[model samples]
Target: MSSILHVELAAEPAAAGRSRRVTGRWLTSLCGAEQPCATAQDLVLAVNEAVSNSAEHAYRGDPSGVVVLHGTADGPRVELEVSDHGRWRDPPADNGFRGRGLDMIEAVAEDVRVERGPRGTTVTFCGTLGQCSGTCEP
Candidate 1:
């Protein structure tokens, strides 16, 4: 059976750190030995990056902003959603800084989706988990 975890927290640097730790623990508990060492590491890195994006770009760095995380861990498939209650935009083609983090997330995730508008931004990532394979190859 699949499960889902949904949560919201302050979009601050400190909160970002906390979210990373929490996600690591949660993934470990949920996947156990079925999740390989390398897979765990990648998940951790991806979670941290997502949280960092929320803190840095969410609300454009507003002190009281909040980011929401929701996802599921079921057997070999783990999915996550990181959302910010802030503004979002497609960076100008001429702009160099453009969507690097979102791009990075897409590269790491086997499947990804993004929703952007005046209300907020949400980035979702998912990959497979294997008992004998901890790393994703693609």
Candidate 2:
């Protein structure tokens, strides 16, 4: 019995807590208390990166954007998405911005998906939670 928790937040600098809390709630629903810790941390980091991108790149730090996140606990998988209505600029040529946030997200997550365009960008990731026994917890 898997379930989904969907959250929508304003793409402001302050939404960080809201973002984290959403991830936490979803993990609690999906993984309970113990083993989900690491999985939940991954979710937190990924969402943080995505939201930072939304706030800094999407609206270009001016705000006036919305970040919509959805977390799903499916069989052996936990999925997440961060979406906003801000355009995506090309990353610096020399790979200079540091940290490789996107790469880290992809590395830790089992699957990653990105949708980008002139209007906005949406980043999504999914990975196994807990024992990952081909069946998710809820």
Candidate 3:
């Protein structure tokens, strides 16, 4: 059996928090009975980072952009995809702070994929319940 959820929000800082909460609630209802709390938390964190990146970089200085979040739970794994219909920009050089969202997403997710094109950018990540023990290879 598989379950899926989707949400669309304005590309803004506040939307990141709202996305996180919605994703967390969906994951809890879908996996909380069997998946570990830590696993769920990790997945939620990854989604949060993805959304934050979109809000911060994808549509920089523009709040009119849109972000779409899709989540699916199948068997023992959960997959999330966050997409923005805006041009992509390279992460800025670290001057002391910032530029850690991608790193943090990779750390928490068992699998991560990023794609950019003229139309938009999409980040997809997945995590397994009680399965991963070490760093997940690309």
> Backbone clash tally for model 1?
2
lDDT of 1: 0.71
Best by lDDT: 3
What's the CA error at residue 79 for candidate 1, in Å?
0.9
Local distance difference test scores for all models: 0.71, 0.74, 0.80
Ten-residue stretch with the least lDDT total in model 3:
129-138
Q: Between 2 and 3, whose lDDT is larger?
A: 3
Across residues 1-138, which tens digit of lDDT does each residue of candidate 2 receive?
Answer: 248877777878777678877676667566655334666777788887787777666777665678888777776577888888887888887876674878888877767888998768989898677643333332
What would the per-residue lDDT of candidate 1 be over residues 1-138, giving only the tens digit for each residue?
A: 226667788888876677777676666556554443566666666777787877777677578898887778777688988888787755667757655766677666767788887888888888765653454332
TM-score of each candidate structure, all chains considered together: 0.79, 0.82, 0.85
**Superposed model 3: Cα runs more than 4 Å off:** 34-36, 130-138
Off by over 4 Å in 2: 34-36, 95-99, 131-138
lDDT of 3 at 36: 30
- What lDDT tens digits, residue by residue, belong to model 3 across residues 58-103? 8877868999999887776778999998989876576468778888
